[model samples]
Target chain A: MKRIRMIALVAAGTVVASALSACSGGSEDGGKDGSDGPVTVSVMEFQQSRIDAVAKLIPGFEADMKKQGKDIKVKLVADPLTDDQFKTKVTQQLIAKQAPDLIDIGDSLVPGWAGAGYLAPLDDYLKGWDGWDHYYPHIKKAMVRQDGKIYALVHDTGVQNLFYRKDQLTQFGIDTAQPATWDDLISRLEQIKQKTGGTPIVIPAGTAWGGSTWTEGFQPILGGTDKNYYSLETGKWDLKSPGFRAVFDLYHTMYSKGLLPVQDLENPNPWEPTKYVKFPEGKIQVSAQGTSGWKFDWGPQGKAPIKGLNEKVDTWQYPGLRSGDAPFGWSGLGFGYGIPASSPNKDAAMLLAQYLSTGKPLADQLVSSGAASPRDDLADVKPYADEPKLLQAGKDLATSVYVPTGDGAEQVAQAVAAATELIINGKADGAQAYDAFLKNATDLLGPTLVKE
Target chain B: MTTIAATASAAAGPTGQASPKRRRRRTWPVVLLLLGPAALLIVVFILAPAVYGAYLSLTNTQLTGFAARDPQFVGVDNYTYLLSNSEFLASLGRTGEFVLYSAIIGQTVLGMTAAVLLARPWVRGKGLVGAAILMPMVVPEVVASLAWASVLSNNSAGTLNRLTGLFGADATDWLQVVPLASVVVVNIWRGIAFAMIMFQAALEDVPGELIEAARMDGATALQIFRFVTLPLIRGPVFLYLLLTTISTIGAFGLVYFLTQGGPGGRTTISAIYIYERALQFSQIGIGSAASMILLALVLVLGLVYVRLAKVEV
Candidate 1:
């Protein structure tokens, strides 16, 4: 009985010890950095390699700051969360008052965070910075809130294009030249599908992130205006608008006529390289993909699985459904850096944000990293200017209309996703889906719904 | 008789009554000393958090930004909304179906077969087979999910599709078409090992003499197993049933990594639905309410298991 009692006591003691250890571990690590130490700047960097490149350049920044009599030390960190996880984590941290000094906020999240007072107003910083003038007007407009305050810097923007196999299009007797209208593209898709017995166009409709292909790739053509889905001038949701309805009908007609890859839409795996791999192998004809695919997934940079695919690949502006006008594409300053409102070192944080946004180091890094810089001053940078495909993409982005950022943006996007899902699943006809989407938009936007 | 008993008690009572009461009072301190830390830890960690979660569930307690600005007393609004939400209802149905098929049927049948095979004296390398079968339980959940995903990939390059192609069968999107079944298979693969090990231990505890006696009575192997072996291992089987049911209900990682409750919510279990609602959509109030409902269900199931199936050692 005594032996059993001793064993039970030891087991209980171990459990207590483990519980105490678990509780104390977190606090102990935090307290190890004594007070009055260097200001720790936690940053959620989306790009790991970019963060590493920034880290390498930090010593120079620190040296420059020291020469200016600032004793601040810099610490760059990278903890990438997926799109959904990033939203949830950043929101949670903001509410808990535990947000990092700097965060990479998506363009879609700017209005929501700004309205919630999680972002610090960057208007004062922008006024003093000359590089603000170099930002394309539409990109700058995208960062501005309804209250007329800039909350973020446009870092990198991407352009959507109709990527097709030149050989495949030629074989099907379809023109490789820019499509005159949405109908022209659809007709070509039908021709390609019929001639080759292969899928024509593949759009990602499996997950929420992939669902953006419709909103980003196709909606601009349908809506006609640069201000496609959201109208900033009118402060209204555009779903009920004629242009939006036309786009939905066009997409539905395309789906019904088998001009789209119907099987892969419902398949869970996103149709990225999997869809395009077939295209290069002569099994698929056309796909809607971002411009980066030219260099990253198709060219010599890509391995044997997708090698030499870019040699036969070409791109054109997504065609407009409305006759007599070019389809105004939707563009936004992709993702940018913002200082948290609750940061202890707000000025220093702003300085870091500026350093990343407009400074020479950032431009140099972008040039070396082969990424496009948002600043027009760096527009002539060799890597971006010399790359033929990237140059075209950059020019397109500079000229495109940006999706508006404000009060009903998130809700409108969600409604659009639901409508697209209905269209893809064949649950609702094109007109019905468009009407349902508009109704949802009107409910979300309330007074913001535009008349006529 | 009372007078004689009173005389005998009068002689004995004065010697011990006060001392016995004093000794009982002294033992209370030792009891507190032994159980004090454990009770404190439980109250602080498990019980406190559970109570706090319940309180938060009652309020409109969102986890972020403006939603946390002024959390209002919403009462049962969240619960009412979730009860009506088609998505949540579908997820509950899916989870119930998964638990029934994977945990109940898969684990029981596979575990019982392994137990029966291992119990046989003629079986060679029984320990090796047990270890080999139990390997999946040791593999990390993420790694296992990735392995299953690779096999279920819709691409023609995937292993299962490649094998099917050899037999002149068309490649099908296995995960997309049969998401629930894929997740169910993955869950069963990870979970069956535990059930098998438990049942195997229970089967070893059954007396060999009884089986030998049954065999002497001209009973076949199936008859001996049904009448003698099964009854002996009833305790472990009951314990495993309860454990497997609860675990399967809470299964998340495999489904999340492999299917992500996709192809139109076919694979969405209750846990995945709660995650999507709370974390993805930032609808914490609804998520908390659904969680509380799940807790209630688990508690009821647990009580029933204890009452009807528990074997007191």
Candidate 2:
């Protein structure tokens, strides 16, 4: 009887131990107290290059936090991933309540994360923080959602426009002036095709590149329209807006006429060949690209930087749908620090984020990564002041168009991409593609939410 | 009759009744010691996740906030949604076609031919040829896909286009023209090696005596192979078919890198479909439903395969 009792006790103990181990919340302690031992703040980074840059700046942040009387220990969770993989991992982590204290949040992912309640609104924190005043109005605007909540701190801004090969255009006797409208742009593309007999222009398309086709390609074209794809005031998808069909028409004309490199768009690395290989060799005359393309792709530190590239390439604002509308570009915040709602060390995390968002750390990150800083004052700093090209590109921000941000915004972006892909791949005509897109949007966001 | 029973019981005594109890008590610890870790692993890694995933399939769980804070149980709504979705249905059909062409027909036929030819004693440099055939399978899937991407690219730099250029033909965009067929060909190239290795082992196991006996009976080489060799290897062939089919259905990395389910959703397999829905679109509930459907399809196919082939173990 004694032996049997002992065995039962041991077996029960084993099962309980195993259950306890399995049930443990993977070391995530909810932030209920802060006066314990050093508060560990988990920092998640997705991009490798950005991780390396951020890793170097963490010590500064930690020291600054320590000086401010917050004993903080920063745990770096740097997992390199592709854009799609990053989304899945971040969402899974956030849902499991295992998300890091501070995570890299892009402006594009802000609405989705904020709506999902994965991110904690930083409005309260920003109001008390001194760094908030230093941020430009556009930077502040880019980080806030339709709910009037600022979800993330602005670290870097992405400035994009139409980049053309000026020397090639001159050689082909093509006009180098800014295209006033879609017709003018099309005529110029035709001239380049007839004269150069190469790919006239290249815009990212297809399901491979995913949301970028909508952001980098369609949204810029959409920007030139009478209305945007989504209205922030009502938080609804404008699927039936003339801008929607016009964007599809633009793709239809470009694809059907072979003006764009339709075949190359299907390649896995669509941007690489066009930006690095074709653009340098004068095979592609024009591309809708970020203004930082010069500094990152064909500048001194770039991969396959061409000799005398500044003389070869010239940046122009992406044109409008009709004449008399000013050429505009798309600008948005890049990766910024956002504390997850489930963070155990929210206070410590916010402190570290505040420290890193400005001063030496921010300047270091911007310089090392070649990203434009959100702070206008940082431009007069050593590196930004020295680089004339960077300043010139930064000036395009005056005409930048910020996309709508709200719940279901990602779905809206995807709907646009699907429509554009349909027209570009010859799956459907503009009208048919528009109709299919309307149905897709209606299915995604119920008919009440989508203005079809 | 009572006397006979009494004598039998007297002979057996108490041992028979107590033996089973004694054996079970003695062996219980040993059973636990041996099977405990494996059982725990199955429960924790495989069974737990599968059960959790099945539970997730019945919800309105998305990657968005509603699903994040509180995932509502919608009870088969995800299944209904997927059923009505044309893209999901088309992807399922494409997956079936991909498995049939790449795994069942292409890899099996090509692998069997290579294995049979290489197994012959008269074949010279068999090792070299075997190594050459196994090259793609040995290389990592992602690396092989990237290398094949370069070779199969439609651009001016592509080897295929360059080769065609020498023949005075214009560069053919093979992948763009027929995206599914292109991925099928690439998958076949990568998979043929595994099939060859498996079939070659099975071919080698075929008894030489039977072949000689068939030959002695005036059977031709082909007849000897057909009559004697084929019957012996049918078991392995069926097993290979089962494994290859299941594996091919799960093939995502290679196809993902090569096409990412485009020109316009042509190459999107069930796995890619699940990924796009779950990860890209943040519709986890729908993705789970699709996954369950795929799992059921694989299971049904496997059951049918076993039943038809009458494979033992």
Which one wins on TM-score?
A: 2
- Mind giving the per-residue lDDT tens digits that candidate 1 earns over A1-452? 25534665676678778887765523111211234444445556655445565777677766776787665566665775455667877787776667777776766677767766888888998888777888877677667777788887767666666677887678667888888787787878878877877667765442344325444544545545434556556655555456777767766787788766655665544554345456667676666666546543454543213555546777776776665667554454566878778766666666667766665666554543334566676656544555666556667776765556465555556566666667766777779878877775564344534444
How does residue B138 of candidate 1 score in lDDT?
Answer: 93
Model 2's lDDT to the true fold?
A: 0.78
Q: List the TM values for chain B, per candidate.
A: 0.86, 0.89
Number of the top candidate by DockQ?
A: 2
| Separate DockQ for every predicted complex | 0.26, 0.36
Backbone clashes in each candidate structure, one number apiece?
0, 1
Off by over 4 Å in 2: A1-33, A39-42, A66-80, A303-309, A322-324, A367-373, A392-399, B1-26, B65-67, B124-138, B150-179, B197-209
Per-residue accuracy of model 2 over B1-313 as CA lDDT, tens digit each? 4643453444455764535455456445545544665677788778888788898899867788433447789899888888898889999999999999999999999999999999888999998999999999889988988897888887778998899899898877777788899899999998899999899999889888888888889999889778888889988889899999999999999998888887678888999999888888887877889999899999999998888678975
For model 2, fnat equals 0.50
Worst ten in a row by lDDT for model 2 chain A: A28-37
